[model samples]
Target: MPSLRHELLAYAVPRVRRSRELDDAERERGRLERWHSGLDRSLPTRLVRHLHQRYEVEVDRTGDFPTHVLTPRTHDVEATVVWMHGGGFVAPIDAFHVRYADRLAQQLRARVVLPDYPLAPEHTWADSHDALVEITARWTASGPTLLGGDSAGGGIAVAVAQSLRDRGHEQATGMLLLAPWVDLTTSTPSTAWFNARDPWLHLGKLKAYAEWWAGSPEDLARPEVSPALADLAGLPPALMFCGTRDLLLPGCRLLAGRAAEAGWPLRYVEEPGLIHVYPLLPAIPEAARAWRTTEGFLGRSFG
Candidate 1:
């Protein structure tokens, strides 16, 4: 049985069904702009701001994207963690992203870099993937590194890692994917079947958003857009989390199978009845456990 806290958190989050109107593009873009404007005032940001008072977080924007570097205040850093923020491929980073990235840096005794990647509608993968490749190439040079993200960001994290491997660059030591949207094409049956069941996602909205982000149907097959279609061999070990109720669970499961077949080291955990990206919620016990487990995994990789 899922934890009562998980159930409560799931219920507390309002459902995000697909809008029936054809003007969703304009409306979604407007909403995204609003979300970006209010992120500094969000509760998660406030709490993390309070907790991270002692840490050193340097904000850098000299590169292709805005990056936040969170350094552990206490302990010698063990590794670097580069986490991408998920906004369904079109949305910008929010308070939750800052909180999670900060927490990961503190807990893992690592330097955490949160990159604000290019979003869809305004930019395509061509614009973002190259920037990411450049950023990861520089970050991974320091030593052991972990790549991670939630939802669409998780998809980006894996794609970036694969891109590095393909280029003969040193890949990340490991990866942490939370409810990754690995397949944008809706190729997996669960993406469609679980649409009504998922509290925060719908297949109709997802497909539309993906199409907008990808810019065309053919681009969905590109490894940077959908890492599920990319070669999974010879990348670093990975830890993946998914919920049975998430519409993207089938794609995650498919990736898990591919990883196993390719002899890639992947630890995948699927929590029954939980929502997508549950680890980002922070209030639930499952979320806490997931972070702890991730820290342990990172420890093993760094050691």
Candidate 2:
């Protein structure tokens, strides 16, 4: 017997998880090719198809890993934000993640690149990694680079940061993660607590994404596969926000503690009553606050 809000969140969680199972995102890769069919395709030939429909942000097609840059026409553009979309590892950059990116890009006054990184079951998903690496390498030699994303992409951001560190590049200024899927292993109390309340996502969907993205021991332990398990030392500071209602909250907590113990400034936000990547829904007041908080965190000096 959960309370009403608890019960509603609990109920909403499964619908969200089922959306993963039934929607194009959680849709099994290769099981269906493109996320949208020709008839389903839009007049605008690109990732942010409905950009015109959205009045606030300016979207441009950047041909790298099917990436897009979302910027505010009126802003100063102080920094750059690279966004990775989350769908376990099987989903594409859907509207939910896009809205978050647009809002962030506009608010932070930073040029933002949102890459629709390939999902699993594709031979090229790793190529998506290479794509990110290539792009990041270009930025590594420069000023403050902020890496952010939701779910799997957030994990990828961590991996990207780690990759830079391993290469001795030290380019990233900070990481902003939203309920990031840091652990492919998926072992945590929150995972089980939100097990029933997450509006979308479940062990089965999680397993499906994992099966497609990783196989064998090497893959499982690969730093990119689960940065939560990866050594958190020497990484830059991070602001990781997770809802108390998300299964991945534990992952966020563990990674934050690991980073802090390793002596990096890792700020973890646990919104008391929200669930997975709640910031995506900008219409929500909490989501708006999250964006403002993120801007404040990222607005400071970065050499």
Candidate 3:
């Protein structure tokens, strides 16, 4: 059963910030203007302030965009995590993303790398894919490194891992995916049913976002854009979580099914009646339990 807090968030978030408006905008001009007009790509001020007090934060400019590295001030680093922030492929990183990364660093004693990758309409997956593959390869060369993200970011993580394997580069030790939007086509038969129940995601907006990120209808099914359709063989162990209330649930299920057939080591956890990225939400019992599950997965993977 969903908690009261979860229920409240599911109700309140949609009312305050609706994506239908974005969906209804003119496809090219209006959508692009609205997306980039007042976009602030920097990390949240509150998150930066908190990181300064408790962790060592450094900015890496070696990539196409900035990647923030956070290490605990009081603990030795046990591993490294490359965490991608989720925003349906357009939104910037928010406080919740950094906060969750910080919690991972503290609890797992890991160095967390948060990449501010370029978003869509202005940039496509091609722009950032090679850079992320290089970054993951560099991290894995030193020690065990995990690739992780939620929503669109999770899809990027999977694509990066695939690229690494195909290129014969050092692969990430594991992956942690949260409600990943792996299929840009949004063609899953069950997705329409889930879309009706999802409070935050709109099917029409998701298609628009997909077209923007993919750059064309022809590229929508490309493995880099729709990783669930990619060959899952030879990838590292992965832990994935999704909720029934998310439109992305069917895509995650598709990835899991493919992983099984390809002999990929993937453990998928599906929560009934939970909202998108339920594990990342604060002040919820379900999120706490998800964190514990994450800790356990990290322990096994790092060993």
Indicate which candidate wins on TM-score: 3
Write model 1 residue lDDT over 1-303, tens digit each, in one string.
789888877777744334232357678767766655655521235657665665677777778777777777777888788988887887777778877877777666778787877667667787778788878888898878888999999999989989898898888888889999889988876566788788777777688678867889988878888898789998898999998888899889988999999888999998888888888886788888888888898778877
RMSD of each: 2.9, 4.7, 1.8
Give all TM-scores, in the order shown.
0.90, 0.79, 0.94
TM-score of 1: 0.90
Question: Mind giving the per-residue lDDT tens digits that candidate 2 earns over 1-303?
Answer: 224554465566557645644344344554544542222211222445555454334333453445565545564667677877787776566766665666665555667677666556563345567667666656556555678878888998888887777777756777788889888777665667666666666666675566568754357657878888887878777888887767677778888878878887788888886877877753566766787778788776353
User: Where in model 3 is the C-alpha error above 4 Å?
Assistant: 21-37, 45-49
Clashes of each: 0, 9, 0
Ranking by lDDT: 3, 1, 2
Q: Which stretches of candidate 1 lie over 4 Å from their true place?
A: 15-44, 49-52, 73-75
Alpha-carbon local distance difference test for all models: 0.80, 0.68, 0.86
The alpha-carbon lDDT assigned to residue 21 of candidate 3 equals: 31
Top-lDDT structure, candidate number: 3
Off by over 4 Å in 2: 1-64, 71-76, 301-303
Model 2 steric clash pairs: 12-199, 13-198, 13-199, 13-200, 16-199, 16-200, 17-199, 17-200, 17-201
> What lDDT score is found at residue 141 in candidate 3?
84
